[model samples]
Target: MLEWLAGGAEAFIGVFNEGGKVFIAFVTGILPTLIVLLTAVYAIIELVGEQRVHKVARYAAGNVFTRYTILPLLAVFFLTNPMAYTFGVFLEEKHKPAFYDSAVSFVHPITGLFPHANPGELFVWLGVAAGITKLVENGTAPFSLAKLALFYFVVGLVVILLKGIVTEWITKIIARREGVTL
Candidate 1:
């Protein structure tokens, strides 16, 4: 009974220590990389000029396939996750949801190559790659994580297209049935 009480205090202290370590690790390890990457991308966009960017956005807005695949993939991957939704401002109100869906779907697939894309869930991608590496070393599986990462990106884009198209059609159908225009 007393030992249980002692254990509770120890667990609480351990949690506090782990929280401090996580904070330090993130500040030192992740923050600088994130800053550099974000700065570099925005700089390139500036160099590319507003007209070129707007032209691409317009082209993507006009097509279901481009709207779902290239638009979200570029925005989500380059702009990072949150502002990727901000990029949806170019899209119509109806396409916004599908845009969000596609953006979110692309995050996980890109993680195979860019783990910083979903830094909080770092272990999810790292764990899978590590497991595959171990298996290949043991001859239990014959796979290259690098190749898998590339395939993951391709499949993710295809899935985003399929999901976006299906959701966009369903949304249009519902709107039409409700006597609304999209």
Candidate 2:
């Protein structure tokens, strides 16, 4: 069956009103936390000094654990996805591709626990969790959004770590044998 539309100025007005509600919700629910988080990241970066960050990046580039895990994790969380790629500039030619693999893979996984990490892709987390949330509200499921977020966060980290390691190893082998086509 189909429903009828208001079919006039009223329908247009109604759509705008609903859009306004979403904008209001976003401003109230996510904006403050995002502002504070971004501010803190910038403040910490400023206080720590770019020179120190570069030194750490150079140091981190040599070790697999630091190279793939700490560096990527920090860069992604510190600068957030696209901007995080800037950190790769500090790495050697061989390490840059591997570091990028780790950094790029982390953007979505991080949104669960830190929505601000990929705020533009918040729907990735929320869309999946929405069904469970409805079930919980209806008392049909035992899960909550906090639990789900935490679960996703932990799993995401694990996946990122594994992906980073494997990709780095593969990249090394490929570059050595095939001239960095990978």
Candidate 3:
């Protein structure tokens, strides 16, 4: 598995690293996107089966699930792993010099993949996008990619709040139907 990743990364890089960072970038950025998609789908299933709020379920499953936003956040975490270990182990055999090159190189702005853009940069941008999305939905601000990324953490916070309330209600109902007491 490890050997294939390093050697095979050049092929898969296109899907995850639109910015082209590849290596750890693909793992952190791309893999997490998959997780988000999976999670959104899972959330939807939970809501539907539990008979929770349809709107939240649909939004999470449909819009958020499909949206490309999660990828950036994933990328951020993916890149944090040691560059050499990530790229060398997975994408290519350890080339000490190339490992250093990837670790230090900054990603290209237009490409987003890179020369080797820092994952942190993409993370911040995604965070901004998330924040902006929240602000827009809440009537707090206008839509803007940067703003959304800036507020992404807040957006997640808001989502969590909403999810908690809704999930709690669902749980209580289910408990009642099952003849269980709170």
Total backbone collisions for each predicted model: 0, 0, 28
* Model 3, C-alpha of 79: deviation from truth (Å): 18
Candidate 2 Cα deviation (angstroms), residue 4: 4.7
Which pairs of residues clash in candidate 1, taking residues 3 or more apart in a chain or in different chains? none
Per-residue alpha-carbon lDDT of candidate 1 for residues 45-149, written as tens digits (9 for 90 to 100)? 799976687678768878998999989877776667666676788899899878888888888888787655666565677668869989889998766899889
Tens-digit per-residue lDDT, 74-122, candidate 2: 7878888679889998777766777788888888877777766777777
In model 2, pairs of residues that clash are none
Off by over 4 Å in 2: 1-17, 179-182
lDDT of 3 by residue, 1-182 (tens): 99889878876766666555545765886557655654664565576653343333233322322111222222222333233123323221212223233232312121122212243455644444457678878887855654443354445434433443344456567777998664
What TM value does model 2 have? 0.80
Q: What local distance difference test score does each model get?
A: 0.81, 0.78, 0.41
Per-residue lDDT of 131 in model 3: 71
Order of quality (lDDT):
1, 2, 3
Task: Tally clashing residue pairs in candidate 2.
Answer: 0
